[model samples]
Target: MKSELRDLYQEVVIDHSKNPRNFRKPEGANRSAEGINPLCGDEITVHLKLAGDVIQDIGFQGAGCAISKASASMMTAALKNKTKAEAESLFERVHSMLTEGPKSSVNPEELGKLAALSGVWEFPVRVKCASLAWHTLRSALAGSGAPVSTE
Candidate 1:
């Protein structure tokens, strides 16, 4: 069982790093922001199309470690069609899980493939890698280019 979980994580990481969904600039994107991690030179641009409080579409473009790319891929997938409030809640859950080093407020099973990234907390340096896109998403939602400090 442990080996199976490890394999699942590896496969998810590979798939997202190789072929991340929503990885292109959106046409007429209403919200967008770019984020960078000086620690590892990871960069990402997050774009969003929102209808009222709901995210109609979400996309991202970035170059980073396997964790970063995979997290962004998982984020885009998890947030699609969700209300802005819902997305924010999800973001908080992920952030707390990664940064707080605790059991996530998010149900791991409900997070779908994103559950693969739960192990990232064990690697401190990689936490920023996993959050690059998330910070970008927050900036986009805030309508600012200000650097987001996740720490």
Candidate 2:
């Protein structure tokens, strides 16, 4: 990545981390789940309002590293109005990007601004921080009350 673009990505992550979006529980949320990253003490809760198979709304709340916070914020934005299948596909893409080595080919354009977080692949441990909320989202969508653990 070019120095200028890297700076921009860093700026996006920092901005989202400092003031995460959709960091509230929707009153009518039908599903919710919590997640923990034992390695970093990052805890997150994901809430979802589903209309049939589509996500009518999504939100999150928690505290963690910049990557975690930013990822959750971006996730809610990406998932709004998306179907469960679309969200699952997105989650899989992100999972591949995070775990399939840094060279993994996940199209940034397809992921939108969330592509900025791809830098996380460089730090294996930080990958947990970035993935905590995503796991929680999956659990929430499944209507499973069990908390997710990224151990």
Candidate 3:
């Protein structure tokens, strides 16, 4: 990554961590799931208010590392008003980015602020932190009552 870009990414992460967006359970949420990273003690709950197959709203609340908190905030911002299929597709793209690093095939512009998290792939352990909210979001969307665990 270029120096300027790396700095910007760092700033984005820090800003989100310090002041996360959508960090609450939304009213009228019909589905919700919790995620825990036992390895790092990051825990989050993702909530969704769905109208048919579309996510009318999304929110999350948790106590965790910066990556987890920021990921939850960004995930909520990204998934709101998106259809279930679109949300699933975005999850796959983000999972790939967090595990394998950013790919040229996935345009950063498509991910918006989420692309800032690409740098997290370098720290494998932190991947769980970055992904906890996403996994919880999926479980919530799936209507799975089980809590997600990164073990």
Can you write out model 3's per-residue Cα lDDT over 1-151, one digit (the tens) per residue? 7874473358778889999999888999999999999887778899999999999999998799888888888889888899999999999989888887755366655799998888887777778888899999999999978999988
How far off is residue 4 in model 2, in Å? Answer: 12
Clashing pairs for model 3 are: none
Model 3: residues with Cα > 4 Å off, grouped in runs: 1-9, 102-104
Clash counts for all predictions: 0, 0, 0
Model 2 reaches what TM-score against the true structure?
Answer: 0.91
TM-score for all predictions?
Answer: 0.86, 0.91, 0.91
Give every collision pair in model 2.
none
Ranking by lDDT: 2, 3, 1
Clashing pairs in 1: none
| Per-model root-mean-square deviation over C-alphas | 2.8, 2.5, 2.5
In model 2, where do residues sit more than 4 Å from their true spots? Answer: 1-9
Off by over 4 Å in 1: 1-9, 101-106, 149-151
RMSD of 3: 2.5
Tens-digit lDDT track of model 2 for 1-151:
7864473348788889988999999879999999998876889999999999999999998788888999999999899999999999999999888776556787765788888887777677678888888999999999879999998
Candidate 1 C-alpha lDDT tens digits along 26-74: 6767888888887667788888997788788899886887788889988
